[model samples]
Target: MATNSTPKKPAADAPAEETAETVTKSAPARPARKSAPGPDVVGPALPAGAEPISVTLAHHHTIDGTDYPPSAKLLVSPDYAQRLRAQGYATPA
Candidate 1:
């Protein structure tokens, strides 16, 4: 007659086997942020003998993605200021 036997496990006092499990994790993605306008979008320089007019811009004046808060005062060229006034975006301060 033959007998079957099972392998024996390590003793409690024995060191445990070391395993090298490679678990790779990717970094989380970040959201895009809005950038401020550069010199290129500031428009051309003031013309000779031309002065900027002080006008209060309305809340809707967000042209070129620039922030112009409501009742904000700014100096702009005469032609541009006039246009803004006509469009109800600005008023003389």
Candidate 2:
């Protein structure tokens, strides 16, 4: 009688399957800028032929009960009044 000499083989294992999902991200939003006067705010009101006027903050005097301190005024062109409106400045009465 002849004996078997072949080596025994291990059982085959089942293969595993995998699934993947992709994700996307967006950049953060930027903050808004505030509208305010600054040191660089000094400039003429408007171009030529636009208007010849100026703007200044309201001031009052004790003696004559009149507006003074013209330095506080913002020398602007006539149309600058419109710009002031956009800037939320009240129109003079």
Clashing pairs counted in every model:
0, 5
lDDT string, candidate 1, 1-93, tens digits: 876688787798985565454335557776444343432323245678987676777754565556666776766677777788888888644
lDDT for model 2: 0.46
Full-model lDDT for every candidate: 0.63, 0.46
- Give the TM-score (vs. native) of candidate 1: 0.48
lDDT of 2 by residue, 1-93 (tens): 998999977657844444342234457776554333433223443675664455554442111222334235554556655655465452362
Model 1: runs farther than 4 Å from truth? 1-44
Q: All candidates' TM-scores?
A: 0.48, 0.28
Worst 10 residues of 1 by lDDT: 34-43
lDDT of 1 at 53: 70
